[model samples]
Target chain A: QNSDASNEPHTVKKSVLATYYHRKFEGRRTSSGAKYRAKKLTAAHRTLPFGTMITVTNPDNGKSVKVKVNDRGPFSRKLAIDLSESAAKEIGIYSKGVAKVKLSYTLE
Target chain B: QNSDASNEPHTVKKSVLATYYHRKFEGRRTSSGAKYRAKKLTAAHRTLPFGTMITVTNPDNGKSVKVKVNDRGPFSRKLAIDLSESAAKEIGIYSKGVAKVKLSYTLE
Candidate 1:
């Protein structure tokens, strides 16, 4: 049944463990050539293209923040995303260090 | 004896209290029209022009970081500069939340 797939919701959502960037790493250049700022709403993903925008929501508090994927990696196999401190804070994970987050991305 | 004012180290340096931006402000629009990122090496000052690069040094530890002025702030009478979390972290202020910093600006 060749139904139109384009008509379906294009937003991709997933659940993953989200952690923040180390504060010590701030000012260091990122893989994207932009210096890492723990205060920016940006994140590092294993494979997402740079500039990819994602909405990360903390399942515990329902708070969400939009971030641009500008770098790569959580490095650990268990964590799916590494967020900047600001991004983590927006989703209520700044103090806890890590949290389970729902990631949503829409196709442009 | 006006020998050479231009050659006599045109870098202006000052000691001021530097604080980090509130994490809640991440993703908000900065005065420069760019989103405020606590993770970027950016800062807010009461009068510095946007994009003015300044070097911030921690007097207690001697650690330093370079940041660009991108917003206007530090409304507090005691604080002279407002740094992003990453900027603060770079100069060893992230953990303490505030610090006595040496600010140096070089003129072109």
Candidate 2:
């Protein structure tokens, strides 16, 4: 749960070691203990403020997905944000397991 | 908090005495205790199963808003559902304070 993303607006956008969650975690709750649906534009971060919106871009595919930080963890110093399955697929990163992503913060 | 809805699919559609929460309730938690944003498509119910999807229709304007049951109630026997302020306004019922609405269920 690294919260290094929000030091400032300048620091908010960076390359992240990102990965998607497995199916077993779907029905479990995180911050609200609310279940996460793979289809929802939501995600988990070590800590960038829950509900913070992050637009993740995959430079390889030139695809992007804007997701809300609703849950927590990738549980590593190297791993930054954990995207939902659909969010990961939105940028063509699901099968790769882990990918470098451009993450930027937004209020909505 | 009348739950006259959901006896069956045939009974899922009915007119309900609906009202919305005041602005003061925005930061408070109901079921999850998660703060609510007025713009989210969410609402409270007496008991229709949490996360249940409800489509509320305002017959006067022929407008409808689809909301998910996330919070819990108006706490009155006569009032059936409590929409969020935005959801109330979406169907043009915010000004009325209270109104009769046709409620329907959907899986999403």
Top-lDDT structure, candidate number: 1
TM-score of chain A of 2: 0.58
**Chain A vs. true chain A, TM-score per candidate?**
0.61, 0.58
- Per-residue lDDT tens digits for candidate 2, residues A1-108, read 235455444324555444455555556555446676655666555324565666555444445555666654433434433333333344444466555544322111
Please, what are the lDDT tens digits per residue for candidate 2 over residues B11-32? 3455544445455555655554
- lDDT tens readout by residue for model 1, A24-99: 7678765466887878867665445567666655444444556676654544333333333434443344465434
DockQ of 1: 0.04
Q: What DockQ does candidate 2 score?
A: 0.02
The per-residue C-alpha lDDT of model 2 at residue B9 equals 38
Model 2 pairs in collision: A1-A46, B1-B76, B29-B33
- Over all chains combined, what TM-score does candidate 1 have? 0.34
